[model samples]
Target: MSWLRALKATARSGLTVERRRLEPLVAARAALGLALVVGATLALFGPGAAISSAFGAFQAAIATFQRSWRPRPTLALASGASLAVSTFLGYVTGAGTHPGPFLALLAVWTFLSGLAWAAGPTIGIIASSNVAMMLVTVTLPTSVAAAAGHAAMIAVGGVVQAALVVLLPVRRWGAQRDALADALAAEADYARRLRQDPVAPFDPVPLMTARSAAAVTPRQARSRPAELHGARGLAERIRPVLASLADPAVGAPAEGPQRDRVRELLAAAASVLDAAAHAIRHGEPVDLPPGAVAALRTPDTVAILDGPPRRAAVRLAALLDDVVETAEPRTETRTPTPTETRTQTPTAAGAQTRTQTASQSQSQPKSRARPTLLRLAPVVAARMRAELRPDSPVFRHAVRVTAVTTAGYVLGSALPLGHGYWAPMASVMVMRPDFSQTYSRSVARFGGTLVGVALATAVVEVADPGVYASASLAVACAFGMYLLMRTGYAVSQVCVAAYVVFLLGMGGSAWTQTVYERVVLTLLGGVLAMLAYAVYPAWETPRLRGRLADWLVTDGRYAASVVAHYANPAGHVCADVREALLDTRAARIAWQEALDRATHEPVRHRGLSRAAADDAGHALAQFGRVAMLMEAHLPERGAPPVPAAATLAEALRRSTERGGKAVRERRVPEWDELRETVANSGPLMTDPLLRKGAGLLLDALDDLSESLAPPTDRA
Candidate 1:
């Protein structure tokens, strides 16, 4: 009964459809790409050639949908090359005289391909496509020469799709625009929170998600997309400032006209950000609201809103300036700096300055050199080496994929079903790194296959699609699949199942028998995938402690950097601090994902209790809020109370190290020294804002300490 209930729930979730505003555009692109490939292939090579071309077109269309842009030519070529290799290999195995060697070859290929998941989603898709192609090849009856011809035709299809992508680019700035829009919307929400309850904890998810989405690739970083990159950078810089202004402890002036001005400034800033987001999304000139500019230039606005809000308002004005600059067309060049300028001076300092200037000019070209693969090879190698550890998630996932996929292949071969390849193919598609994702995908695959096969069967019986109609159906299904791929697994699966049915029908398979075989084999494959995990699951709970410790270490370093900046505001922002913040975000994201995975695992395998995990999560979030506040203070230029700031910095750093140790060693951290440091800080600390910020940090540390305490020790 429990199993039945679970199954019912899974099916219901799988069937739920999510509609996105961009679905129509996505559907249109998919349909057009598929239609072009199918129509061209049929005209040139007839129905038989259309089969191989269709597969190629399918691969290319999916690639476009994955990134929504034409990949760099080199990457596109590499992808096409991979597809060709896989198609050829599949063809060879299918044409071989003996079944034993083919089966052995397939097992090895599946195992090796499974490792591609470690690289990322794109590579993983390529690997899976290879396996799927092999399954298709085995079903076709053809000679070696015919197989080679088909492979060539398939490669051409991929090339055609790539060409289409290059010629018809869609939504070039879509991802970046969406990211900025989300950030703006989040700022509005944050402002509302400040108005309603300044003390309420801010959710960092939206800011982080948008920033991650807006992150540029190395290639893009080198290119001259200044406006997009500049806007993204400004958005990141503005986030911490916004967070600081929303701090409840820093209240508005009680009885001053400046208080109302400050409120007006906040509203104005929010409006400007919203307008900028709209402009970026719509590709129009940014038109600031009428009162927004006036609010920034108001006589007493800066003086009255002194402290974080004042600093934030000033920065917000600078950001608006940047947005206006970005909206304008660039048509002028700046004068180049002179390499050498002779100045009459009798002192040694003059000659030294000249020498330094000459050396800097000589080195400028070297510094501006573009990155090459040779230079990046060492970094990539080192990262791969680090992830090669047996304890690493990527390594473990790779091993799991190999073992399960091999088992799936063996099971499929042993089955008496006519189309046994479907079983292993289904398994290959469903297996993922985490338990929840794998289970959900498995359920979705099963339910979706049922729906797809049923729909395809009814269509075949009622319409009896001939060659042209089958091709048309294939194009339609391909479009639908790509459109819904990100929406939900089950919804996407429905399209996939329908597409396969049309494809097989074109190959002259009996419709009823084909649907039956696919349904049974799909169910068998899903069961195999689920059972593989059940037998030796990689539960996330056991790994939570390590993940938490990593976050503590990274975040602690970031806090230390922030403290250093506070002590010496004249110094430029430290690159290490920026990198540390990024690392902290990564670590936090990983921990959250692990916690989510643990939630879905059985009680026996969930190492931490739910209450304990929730408490830790809350503590971590508070820590993030404090870190953002400290970061917000980074741009302040006035001299700080050096001794006091340094003392607080040291205490905060030491607290982080202790917290990391406690999590790692399963012991309570000693917070006595930190508490003492915070409590004994002198009245010489003149900056009220700094004092308040330090108090916030101390409170966060205390909360974290309490959360980490053993259950027996907690009140």
Candidate 2:
């Protein structure tokens, strides 16, 4: 009955959570996305059919590798450099050759293409750019014409996408910014909540889910550049929000009432947010600090009122007042420096005794050293092997996605007015881990394409490519824009688009006719690619949830083990727990990105979410109680001994280890002798050394538990 009730409750809660939070974003994206798709398609069909065909082919190739590529800084640079080198080498070698060996170029292209496939789009672009430059410089007439055709098609697509973004009714910027901000707030809130309630079923699953949704899309991190009008304002806003996370305290200070008061206030603030989120949908009144609501309404509240509560109104007043008013870490002043240095008397006799003590302490601590990573190595390796090998289904799927996308682009290149270009660009944007990622990519792609198109049009109108000097200047502007890669992807697309137009005009050959043709091809490729992504998306939600679960379980177990041994004395239990906690935390962080990808896969995500919640709740409960127990066991003069706790501690340790092994491996070990040994060990605290050892172990245990039980995921 209890289990049944729990299931029902979880299901009900999931529905409410999805409805109140995720649904709106989905709705908004869908509506705006449709418009973008239709507009881009129509624009492309109106221009040069051949240009559109080539543009589509390029997008298809990019789409094939879309799953592997990202706009990450290092990846971009590496890809760009590779492309530049390849282009120079290919051009120099092939320029004098008879049409160059198609197979050799294909082989080199394949290898570089594979790297682009593995590394991502930025690298692929570098390779593509090189291919363009090489063809133009190498093969006299036919090859150069083909290279120009490819470049022109790509630029057209860029312009069209950018135009769609600007003209469409979409809150693209707001969505991206909101996603990042929410993630930060969620981290703080989860930490605070878990710290206070420990056992109230703390689950990082929801937090992971939220994060996966947010991370699938990223905005440009740079501040305003010369061309971007309001980019500086956005950067300024984000910077302050990040800055607010810095801790006011520099170091650990003397424990006092002020510290206690501060803890109380922070706990209070967390509770208020939880209550608000819980109540808002139910139409119930939620209580908060006096100024929380008013604070949420202010611009300053952006940093605080994010995450689950979904309001900045309450955060500004709470944080500024709380953080500013809290007393700083107190400094401890000793007597004179000379006296402090001399306090550790090292007379010959004393030195010998001290050496013996140090050796003993070291030995004791060493017994507790259990390398957790080593224990889990087999499991991790096995999982990785399964996921990455040739036989793995996911790998096969990735290959298929790439092949299909590439085929589309190649076919599109044969078309007339470049109306096929939109299909390929869409393929690149939509081929992510989930719908959210697809949406984000689509939005960015659309915006970038449109901007590129507009820029190209403006340049052509001004320069009128019949004049070689004017056309050259236009090309230079496009190249300059490409160099400003630090700007948002959207802006960079515009620059590249304009450059495409210059290249298409064939250096003052003809301008007006080419601009329209370029736009048409790009739009054609983008549309086709988008269709592929929408039809069969692979989500990232499940894996993210799994990571959260592991962290929670590891943290909880460590806390329990630490507290159990601390309360009793003279056992290796606390040390073991601490080791386990450390291992779990490390593992949890490593798997975070994988888990985020899983969040998009609904079927797998549900299972991961459940596990994450269960583990987190257990961890919070264990850590909370352990923290309390540690505080209770604080050193004092002549405190009463905990009777018979030593025997209990040993028994618990044996039981825990046996049970843990069973849980992890599904096998029971022979434990008759271990149980007897635990039974024989009695009254541990009676020995002074044992008592001291227990006290020493407390610090490590606490640190491990806290580290494992972090409130939010940090990547």
Judged by lDDT, which candidate is best?
1
lDDT of each: 0.65, 0.37
Write candidate 1's Cα lDDT for 374-463 as tens digits. 564465456546666667665666566666666666676677767777887888788776776777788899889899889988998899
Root-mean-square deviation per candidate:
7.0, 16.9
Best by TM-score: 1
Q: What tens-digit string does per-residue lDDT give for candidate 2 at 1-715?
A: 1334433442332222111222333233322322233234335432232233223322322222222212222222333333334434444444334323432553455333323423334434444444433333332224545444433443444333334334542433343334323433443474364334322232334333333322221233232111112211222121112112111111012244323322333444444334433322232333344443332223322322222121111222223222211111112531111111223223333343234323322343111111233343465445434555444333433433454345444555456644333344344433442344443444454556566667767766775554344334433544344234333445545655665565455333355655555455445544554444445434344344334434434543544454445454433223464465445545555355454434333344343344543443344344333332332222222345455444444543454454344333423223353335333433345533334333333333333333333346311
The TM-scores of all predictions, comma-separated, are: 0.86, 0.42
Model 2 residue runs over 4 Å out of place are 1-81, 84-387, 390-401, 418-435, 463-488, 503-520, 531-537, 542-545, 552-715
Candidate 2: C-alpha RMSD after superposition: 16.9
